[model samples]
Target: MGAFSFLSRVLHTKPSNYSKILVLVSVSSGGLIAYAESHSNNETKIVEQSQPEPKRKRVVVLGTGWASISFLQDLDVSSYDVQVVSPRNYFAFTPLLPSVTCGTVEARSIVEPIRNILKKGNGKIHFWEAECLKIDAKEKKLHCRSNIDENLVGNNDFSLDYDYLIVAVGARVNTFNTPGVLEYCHFLKEVEDAQRIRRSVIDCFEKAVLPGLSEEERRTNLHFVIVGGGPTGIEFAAELHDFVHEDLVRIYPEVKDLAKITVIQSGDHILNTFDERISTFAERKFQRDGIEVLTGCRVVSVTDEFINMKVKATGENVKVPHGMVVWSTGVGTRPVVTDFMEQIGQTNRRALATDEWLRVKGCEGVYALGDCATVDQRKIMEDITSIFKAADKDNSGTLTVDEFEDVIEDIIISYPQVELYVKSKHLLEVVDLLRDYEGNKQGEIDIEGFKLALSHVDSQTKSLPATAQVAAQQGAYLSRCFNRWEQCKRNPEGPRHFKGSGRHEFRPFSYRHLGQFAPLGGDQAAAELPGDWVSMGRSTQWLWYSVYASKQVSWRTRILVVADWTRRYIFGRDSSRI
Candidate 1:
């Protein structure tokens, strides 16, 4: 009846109370209609008690990271009922996580609420702050659990259903099963994990300064050992180095030079994933800050007060005592993904097998995207030109968008992303859109006068990423897709093809890799910017700051980061933690 009523209904309050007033609206309208004030569609009819029909196809997407968010942004929202399920309601830009841990940037700057992104609801995409426990492919239902504290509230579990599903659950950091690792090693994967680490680092410095402690105990507590020389581990070690020099020495001179930070990586270099130049530069910087670079080292165990490591070069074991140890290795699949794959029995080589269209093999209404899916996209080789000829029934060669969508949808349902034809991208959009189309209950679609409408079938979460760019990109992509899907549904026969209306129109998703850059202290930094190997100092530091500043998510956030930097220049990085 009004905004208040919609709000009440959405909040699950007294919705009926507000809806009762709707009866009066029709009587008033009927009086106008009788006075020759009739609208074009209904010359004399009075409308009453009508609700917008809920779209039939429910599409559930997992994860709030780069892939899921991107898919949400780009999907046609008007055509289907869309829902996003994830642990965190906000999309965290992961690249800046290390800075947050070191107090260089506030944690809130890198996070954007999921609701804010979905406010432009083209097809009514909803948000669910929970983790998907399991998937029943046969029933098309998801078992989910809220990440919030349910014991405090006494209620939390729920289940959701979907007609089409996209699993974008990403990977988690892997620790290689090191002994005592789960018990003693802190991980820098999440914000809370970082804050806990920051406090622990500060606490250790103070304890080392206590007079009653023996030299061995003090050294053991003051030592900061970071295992894994990956980007996460290196950034953390560098930040700790700055905190000690910039704040620790001045605050507690008694323990000056007492704090030790070590980075142990298994490879010959750190950040092996990046250009060699970036890796070398990172090493020189680490050495300059008095942080140890123990390359070619393997961690054997993590104890309450020391880390047991092995020098791979010599096969000699080494023990480094420490108050806190952080493990920042790369990532691997999570339980939800593995178990679901096994249950489906369609997964091979530890990944979901999908054709070029991203459809799961041996399944219908199930799709896969992002890191969870290992789609080659090169396997598709259907002669799309033939599709033009195929849809040309009686050789007319004229195609309609509505007819095209039906043709392409039917074709893609049988074929996951496997053909060289999928490279056209427009074809991919057609296929992805078909994933949620609800009209074809028989799963058999035919476009009249279309030559290539007949087709065969094909097909295809874990967590959010550590980088914000990936998270944001995914958010934007998914949103766009939903928006377009909605638009297509409104005009089923419009220029947008539903089934080989002879038009090759569809949006394709593309990923642009941005090189890695993180802020290091005092005219020093490291960049893995799309090139060769070798460390650059002094010259690239300014460029590094520029990169970080430009990627602050928004102008307001950039301003906050700039202000924080300026204050740090004048006051130094704050080491005081109470």
Candidate 2:
């Protein structure tokens, strides 16, 4: 009865006290729920913080020429933070530069802004209009100075750090230190150079028309002398011929008869790099076109009014008066490149030395290409040894000329870089020379003898032609290798590290020769296709146009170039100087 009375007292407690107990329970439940939610949010934040950011390597490109521009175009920017340092901010289509001097093409039409190219990349690319002064490979840094005039007083000098550096700063025209040559001659390596030549040509013509000038003086003022029978000099001579025949006949008829274009080649023939047949054809064409081509003549010196040449065969000296001279002889290493090579102990004095993979010798994380670099001879020797191993059926340790021919064929099949020489018949000549070597009396060459003979052959075929095509191919190749290397780094388990010494870790660069084409004035062009085929005439002229049009770097450039050509065809070139 007492327990029942206590239970009844508890059940009948006051309504206010009951409500207080209910509130306590509700508050405790709410607090526990809030704590649980807060803990969940904190855990999510921790996870978000723990996730890693994507890592990108830094790449520094050192030029704005064909090689550097093509590399930038092919680079996977998302994988790199790219910085470009160059004095110029645009890429000039060098193949068309000769046309610019003759007014067949405009200067601006052949240039593409470097900024526009970089903007097309996946990530933001930094560009500095500065000249690279020195590279501290040990520190992976570059010493650069602004090209802007206001910053020339050491104010805009700065240092840049990079994980990878590309040295593609191309070579400069070599004057051979000929006396007065630098003062009297003009070069054609840059847009400014072309502009200067055009201005000088026009000035010469204007001066020749002056009333006080005698016939001899007029002839002297109208003469155009070109040195170095390489493709550049030949092309310029052809263009000048067309300009004299087509434009000068109408604009300045008074000097047309006196105007003469002469190409002075130190070698036996102009276009000596091309096939002999092609060289013969070009010489014939020039002869028929009334352009004087003087071969086996070495220029001894140059003056403002005359050039003295020694006939290599007769040992006789001859002097030719000239109003203008264009020197397109060859290229030499820049002072900066020479300094860098010296610091790195590179043996190649003419250019930067690189391995088969285009990695600069003695410098890690640095690569070089274009006319500025030469691949190591040891790489070529290695390739030759591998080819010999494959071709040695009897394992005799010696190879005949026939076997060497087979080796050349094998190289053509395996390596694209040699395709140009092979297709152009240079490889066959190399084989012939090997067969005729005095040491190989029995017509069989031992390994060492083969290597010695090959060194000579390599001297003939080692460096690639310093053409825009070669540069572009090298640029694209390096970009691909870099992308693959980065991918390999990201995937450790996939294969060996890209830097490992595996035989196939990274493929060495091989350049495929597309073909060669040159416009010969008067709606005629000549082209040597891959293999033994050669084409010429008007149809080939159209082919030349189409090929160059297809090679235009951008759609805008293509349109501009086409429009410029069309305008020249319909309305003639604008001869007015700006």
lDDT of 1 by residue, 1-578 (tens): 68547534543433344432222233333332112222233333334454446656888988876667667666666667888999989866666677777677667767778787787784388898999999888888899999998667745778999987888787666777778988998887666777788778888887888889887787788888888887678777877887778778888887785678888888999878667767776777778778888999999988897788899889999888888888888665678888778877845444565543456666677766655665443212344555565555555456545545545554443233423235433453544433323523223233332223323212221122345454455446545544654655431111323343544233333333466664455567766554333345666677776777786545766787777778777977767562
Cα error of candidate 2 at position 420, Å = 9.3
Evaluate all candidate structures by whole-model CA lDDT and list the values in order.
0.65, 0.79
Top TM-score prediction, candidate number = 2
Model 2 per-residue lDDT tens digits across residues 128-225: 99999999888999999887988336587899999989999999999988998889999999999988888888888889998988999999988999
Worst 10 residues of 1 by lDDT: 455-464
Best by lDDT: 2
Model 2, position 542, has a per-residue lDDT of: 95
Model 2 alpha-carbon drift over 4 Å, by segment? 1-55, 151-154, 377-461, 490-505
Would you list the clashing residue pairs of candidate 2?
none
